[model samples]
Structures are given as structure tokens and as C-alpha cells.
Target: MYTLLIVDDESIAVRGMKQGIVWSDLAITEILEAYNVKQAKQLFANHQIDIMICDIEMPGQNGIELLEWTRTHYPDTVSLFLTAHADFTYVQKALQLGSFDYILKPVKHEQLKDITGQAVLQWKKNEEKKTFSVLHKQYVQQWEEQLPHLIERFWQELLGERVLPKSKQIAAKLQQLNIPLTLDDQVLPILISIEMWKEEFNARDEEIMEYALRKTASELMLASWPGTVIQDRNGINLLLIYVKPTDPIIRDEVQKICEEYIRYCNQYFKCSLSCYIGESTKITEIPGMYSDLLVMERNNVSASNKVILANEQLQVRPFFDSSATSFPVMDWIMLFELGRKEELLEQMTESCTYMEQKSGFCKEDLESMHTSILFLLFSVFHKKGLSVYEAFPSKQLIDSTINIRTLEQFRTWMYKVISQGIGHFMLHAKEESEIVIKTKKYISEHIHQEFSREDIASYVFLNPSYLSRLFKKETGISLTDYILKERMNEAKRLLVQTEMKISQIAESLGYMNLSHFITMFKKVNGATPMNFRKKIQ
Candidate 1:
């Protein structure tokens, strides 16, 4: 609803206009009447007036002056000038002040209604545009702010909550802006595999390696052509060059560049380096292409060490699929535990090989697959008393900015680590599985004896907290709750079949404090123990 202010110095004009016009029918619900400009100004400040119908020549302040005031302050408020005199200058001045439409004195009812309706439509359109612009900007800003945190959480889950020192990763990510890729744009994703020969190195050394890599990559690309590149720590360098390629024969120009650097660095230091070039992708598809590159790189570990290789045909299209089928990776792990080793290995090897083959996959696609696989892997690993960090042991590789191109690479890299990890952790899982079953047996045999989580933990040789989490994950209920349910069920049975008293039943279930046992029984069953017995009887 909009408020329309009527301003006129003449008393008769104001009365006739107010009474004669049906403001409500015109879609102007609220009306404020002012005899002069001063009261109109006060009304304008206090309320949101959509349209001002004011007399041109007033006693104190004219309509022209009022329009000027509105123009300066309340610009959104539409102004319609009313003039008695047929002065050309006054008409021109009203238009110059941006009056919606001016009406001469003794205005026709038809003209007034038509103009008001037009002004209302214009006002609504402007408001809608304003709303849409605000919403769009807000949505973009929220994603911009939240994207990094979400990415970090994803990597954390992928690596199984392994805390890697993040300064290098943070610096690399900060350097890489989210550049949009178009089909026409020539963006190159270079996956550089970096390794340290020396075991002892501090944060300073890591920073130096990052700086050397970025500087070297930048200098080489800039010297070759006029281009700008942002190097992320992931060891994946993205170069966006506008230069037209001079050599038509240069089949692997990007690979050549990476190989030259790798060879140069290897000669200078004991540290080995390898670089892989993913297929050239349009800007919009870079993220998905980057992921495929990572997968491809992981698979490359199985191949003989090459400083750099250009896999021009390493496309990311194969990895882009629905996540619905991906969730079975956990179910695969459980199947592995059930001695379906052949099926488990086949699935793991196949999936890893696929990722290894497509290291040039875009970051968006890579992260999606990465999240799906990591969650599945973690579900089983966490259940079996191992964290993701311990299972993968490739935080450096997984967290790197370098694009993985192929499933073969991921297969080669992950298979060994995961298989060895299984060997190390499987025995512990068996032990825990044994303890869990034993604990259940102990509880059933000695339900009349006092038991605490600490006692169970001690018997199982596991941490109390870890055991609690494991019990909940495995059984979908807490240890204490399961025990209580069992005891309560036994008490109910005894009450109906053996004619046991409520106090005796409580004692039989290992509760020395009869009142406490009765309270627990009431809480679980929503009735007193005696009442439960009576009802059952």
C-alpha cells in the first residue's frame, strides 16, 4: 500500500479534491492532506509517500519548490504537479523536476486516474528490480565467503581428519582465484608431482619449494607468451594465456614446458619432480577438469618416473556421473570384511584406476568424486578403528592443488596405501569385533552384576570414549541404553512368568538402590515397576 499526499494552499480546492476522489478505488490506500508545503515536508519525512499531488503556486512554498525538496531527499516518491495558471515556465519547471505527469487546475477525473495507475506500475517494477538485484548479490556473496570453508571441510573428511599444517595449502589456495572458464578460452591445467628426497625439512623449506615452483612456472610461461597464471600449492598450475600459438607442430607445448622444469630441478637437486598436462578445457569446465587430472596423476605413480608427461586426450567427461551409485563404496568395505575380498579389490582397483586415468578432471568433478569415495572409505575405516589419515597416508598428495587426470593413477597410488593399511588395521578390527561380541556375551551372562562403561572398556582393551562411539555406530544405540533395555526386558519377563516382586526384580537386574531402579523402569516404560507387573498380571 502506498500513501498519496495532497498539498494545496486553497481550502476549497483541498476539500473538493479529498471528498470527490475515491483514493481507495485508484489503488492509493492511504492519503495525507496538507494545506501548505511545510506540512507536506513533515509528512514526507515521517511517511513513505508514493505520489504527491500538489498545487504549483502555494502561499509559503510552491509545488515546484516541494518537488525540488522531494528530488533531493525522497527521490523514490513520485510527484504529480497541479497548476492553476497556464504559465509555460511553470509547466516546463515541473517536468524538469521529474513530475510523473502534470495536471492543469480543474483536472479531469479520467486523466488523474490513468496517470496514477501508470505511476503505480512504474513504482512496482522498480521495487521488483531492486529486490532481485539485492537477492542475487547476497547469494553470490554467501557462496564466495563459504566456499573455502566448505572445501577445507571436504579435504579434512577426505584425508580422515588428519591435521596437515595448512599455511602452504592456504597460501596456494589464496593465490588461485575462482576464474570462470568459457568454451572459447584457452586454459591449461598442469599437474606437477613434487617430492622431497630429504626427510628433514621444516615449514621454511616447504615455503621455499612453493615459492620456487610458482616463480619458475610463472617466469617460463610469461617468457614463452603473454599470459597470466595463478599457481596453487596443489602442485597444479593453471595458466590462462591469450597468446596465439606460433608453432603449429607443437603437439605437447604445455608438457614440454613442465618436463623442462622437472629435468632442470632434478639436475640441480636430489628431489624428483613430474608434471602431467590435462586436456585443454574451456574456463567454465576447469574445476571438473582439474579433478580428473588429480586422479590421472595418482595412477601415474605406477608408471616409470617421468619428469613430465603430456596426456592431451585425458578428458574429464568420464568421471562426471550421478553420486547415487557411488555410495556403495562403503558397502564394498563391509563386503570386504565379510571375506568378499575378490569383489572388494576389483571394485577398489577399478575405481582408483579410473580416477588415476583422469587427473586432468576439473576440481568440481574431482572434489565430488573425492567426497563420495572418502566418505565411503571413512565409514568403514572409522568403524574398524582407523582414521582416514591412517588409511590413506597421502594427505600431501590428496591436499595438493595439482590436478589428478586419471583413475589409473589414483588406483595405483591408493591401492598400495589402502592394502597395506588394511593389513596393519584388520587385526585390530578382528580384535575389537571379538571384544564387542565378548562384551555382549558377558553382559547377558552377568546381567545381575554391576557393569560400567569403564569395566567394558577395560575388558575390551579399548578407550572408553572410542568404545562408546563404536558401540553407537555399530548398534545404533549407546552401551548404557542397550544394557538397560536388556535388563528391563528380563525384569518384565520375570514379573509375568516367575511371580517375582518389583524390588526383587530390580535386585536381580543388578540395581542395589531399589528406588533408582524403579525410577529407571518408570522412565523407560512410562509406568512404575509395580504397575507394570500388575498390568501384565
Candidate 2:
């Protein structure tokens, strides 16, 4: 008899699985249920579970996380994942975590029984290895199968600086993982960077494709040398070839292998990538070589689908400037204000495209472009009276700009900030003519004060051009005309009702020069201020 555990967030589904499955047929007499990963972990702690059928999607912790834990703590327990998520990431993680089977849910009763019976059979097979020789054989077989992954992990840890990089520590780890290498051994490292993806893929798909690429590189490039391709903590792929630095033909072989590899990847993996090769160095010194190759990749913006060596003409130079330095940051403000959306975006795209295609453009170029666009957009937003936070909306969208990795990503973020900021300005620029009414009200309040259009604009918190354009567009009158009309009408009010002279009326209406005020009043009200007062009387 075998014990089994069913883990699903839906208690009803767990109940159904417990009641529907005939455990006796599969020699599984006991069954347990857990609502989530935490509860399932609790069940595992108490029981000697031989089989576990867990759902992949749960609230607190996912089935993959539980499976990872189970594999570490209870490797003998055969685990199967039952999940609605057919996501490639989940499937990949499940397999990597040593899950016995991945059964998609809404699985038929017969299918469940068949799968569960197979799981039981596998568990029983493990349980049957009771003799010391049989146990030893099983362990040896498992170790052999796991040796590659272990070695890869060791390399990752060593280069990632997670483990001690001393010679003794390194030699001990190499021996433990059965990797045939020593401190004196030299290894040439090459950095592979995915410049472009011809096909679209999610994060997990990209990871799997990277894995496939590494395996392919191992097959093609490391056939003659004793080496392997391992990924660093930063997700950078490095091909470590164990050979002497004095090997004369190694550089040529690296170039040939990289050329063929790039062609194969471009055709098969649907990606355009470049390989940056570094010189041979000691195993511990591989990290330094990897860092140098990374510098080459980061600095190269135009070169892709080719092999580059450390001593090449296009080498990593000192801190320097890009080809496109003088980007027109000032012109973007005018384009935005004029609502030239398509023209501005086209120009920006052309600039970034040039950077992507031209040499000497690097991470610093992308950063400069990003900074210029951000400054221009924010200046436009401030001029148009839109809040920066409201324009961006999501915090992540703005925060993502802090660590831009590629030209494409930089261009994408630029477009998002531009489209959102300029689009918002376009949407709200005309603003229901309320600012026009507000401007008129502020002018009326200070009609007697000697205030220019600048003062009124300051009061209304708008640019003078914005205040002027909006006032004219919405009120069908120029700001000067509107102010003149209001002040003349106020002069007329003082002319008839109050016992003030025409000169006093003009002066009270903020026209210190009475003669000049009369000329302006005559132009607006069809008569001079003094004449208009006599006519009204």
C-alpha cells in the first residue's frame, strides 16, 4: 500500500480527487488533501508520502515551489503536477524540479487513474531497492545523471562569486562535482549576447532558447576542447574552453565555430546574436576574462551575427562618447507643443535606428537618448500643466527607465513616455474653455491694476502662450481684445455712475496715459473713453 497527497487551492477538487480515485487498485490505501502549498508541506512533514498530485496554480506558494522543496527534502516521493496552466515556464520548472508527471487538469477519471497508477509503479520501484547493493547502484545512477547539472551549478557559483574563489576551495569543488580541472588549467571564455530576436517569446521561452543555444554551442564549439557553456548570475552566457593560452590555433577555431554557430542560431533559433571571445586564462581568472568579454558586448552597439576577439580593432575602449551625441532636446518641446506627434516620433525613431545601426553607439548612447527624451517630455508636460505622475500612471513604467539594457528597450520606453505624455497633452490641451473663463475672471478682478498678460498667466498658472492661445481659440477673441473690452466697459461704468472725470476713469482702469487709453478705447468701443462717457450720459 502507498500513501498519496492531493494539493489544490480548490478544496472541492481535492475532495473529488480523494473520493473518485480508487487507491486500492494502485496499491495506494491512504490519501491526504491540502488546500495550498503550506498545508501540503505540512502533510509531507507528518506522512511518508510516496506520491503527490499537486496543482500548479495556488495562492500563497505555487506547485513548482512545493515540488522544488519536495525534491530537495523527499526525493523518493514521486510528485506529479496537475494544473490548468499550460505555460511553458511551469512545465520547464516542473521538469527541472524532478516532477514525475505533469497532467493537465480537467483530466478524465481514467486518465488520472492511469497516471496515478504509473506514479505508484515508479514509487514502488524505488521502494523495492532495499538491499545495500541495489541502493548503492540506484544512488550511483542518480549521481551520474545529475553530474552535469551539478558541474554547471558549480561553474555558475564559481564565476558568480557566490562561492570562495581560492585555489583550494576551487579544487575541492571541482573534485566534488567530478569536473576534471585544476588551478593551473587555462580556459578561454567567450561571451554570447542575444542582440535581436526575430521571433517573439516570453521570458521563460527566452530562457529555454538560451539553454538550447548553450547546449548547441557545447556540441559545436567544445567538441575538440574539454569545456562547457554556463550562464552567469546576470544571465550572461559564457563558453569556457579548457585549454592552454599558448595554443596557436585556438583563436582561429573559435572564430570558425562562432561563425557557423551564429548562422545556425539565426536560422533555427530565430535570434541574431554576437559572440565576444576573450583570451585563454586560468580557471579562477575566467571571471576576469568573462568581465572583459561582457565589456566588449556592452560597448558594441552595431556589431551582431559576427565573432569579435579582445585584440580586434573594435575593442572595448576607455570611457568615451557615442557617434550621435548632440540630440535635439530643445526641438522636441516645440514639436510637442505644436502637436506634431507623428513627425516627432518619426524623427526620434530615426535617431534611435541610426544608433542601432551605426558603430560606436553603446549603452551610454542609449542612456543619453533616454535622458534627452525624458527631459524633453517632462518639460513639455510642465509647460502644458499636466502632472508627471498622472501622465505616467504606473510607477513601474517610470522606474523601469532606471536600468535600460538595450537600444530596443530604450526606444520602447521613449515611445511610451512620449506617447503617454504627448497623448495626454493632446487629449487635455483644449480643456473645455474653462481656462479662458478663468482667465477672464482673473482679468476682471485686477482690471484696475497695471497687470500685463504675464501677470494674468501667472495667476491662472498657465504659460502665456497657452493662456493666450486657449483664450483666443475658446473665446473667439484675442487676450488683448478681451482685456481692452472689459476695461473700456468698466470705464464706461465709472463714466456714468461715479462722479469721476474721463481722465480719472482712464487712470483708474490702469491706463496711466489718458491719451493712449482713449486711443485704445476708441479702437475697441467705437469711440474714445471721454466721447463714450458723453454718449452714455
Leading candidate by lDDT:
2
lDDT of 2 by residue, 457-527 (tens): 66765534345555666666667667777887897788789988878887788877877878777766788
Clashing pairs in 2: none
Best by TM-score: 1
Error of 2 at 112 (Å): 55
The CA-based lDDT of model 1 is what? 0.62
lDDT of 1 at 85: 77
Once model 1 is optimally superposed onto the true structure by TM-score, how far is the C-alpha of residue 249 displaced, in angstroms?
52
Write one digit per residue (lDDT tens) for candidate 1, span 1-537: 778888998888877777777878768888889988899988987999888888999887788998999999988888887887789999999899888888888877777778877888877887888899999999889988987545434333322322233544533443453422223445555655553332222334545665676567678755765444444433234444432334222436655776677777666544555566555554444455455554454333233235333443332312222233443443454454555556666876666546547664455645555555554455455446455565455663366325455555555545554565556556556554544676687788878887665566556544343454456556666566777787888887887889777778888887888988887788778998889878877
Q: Which residue runs does candidate 2 get wrong by more than 4 Å? A: 1-130, 162-164, 244-249, 315-318, 321-537
Query: Where does the lowest 10-residue lDDT sum fall in candidate 1?
Result: 314-323
lDDT comparing candidate 2 with the true structure: 0.75
Q: Scored by CA lDDT, what does every candidate get?
A: 0.62, 0.75
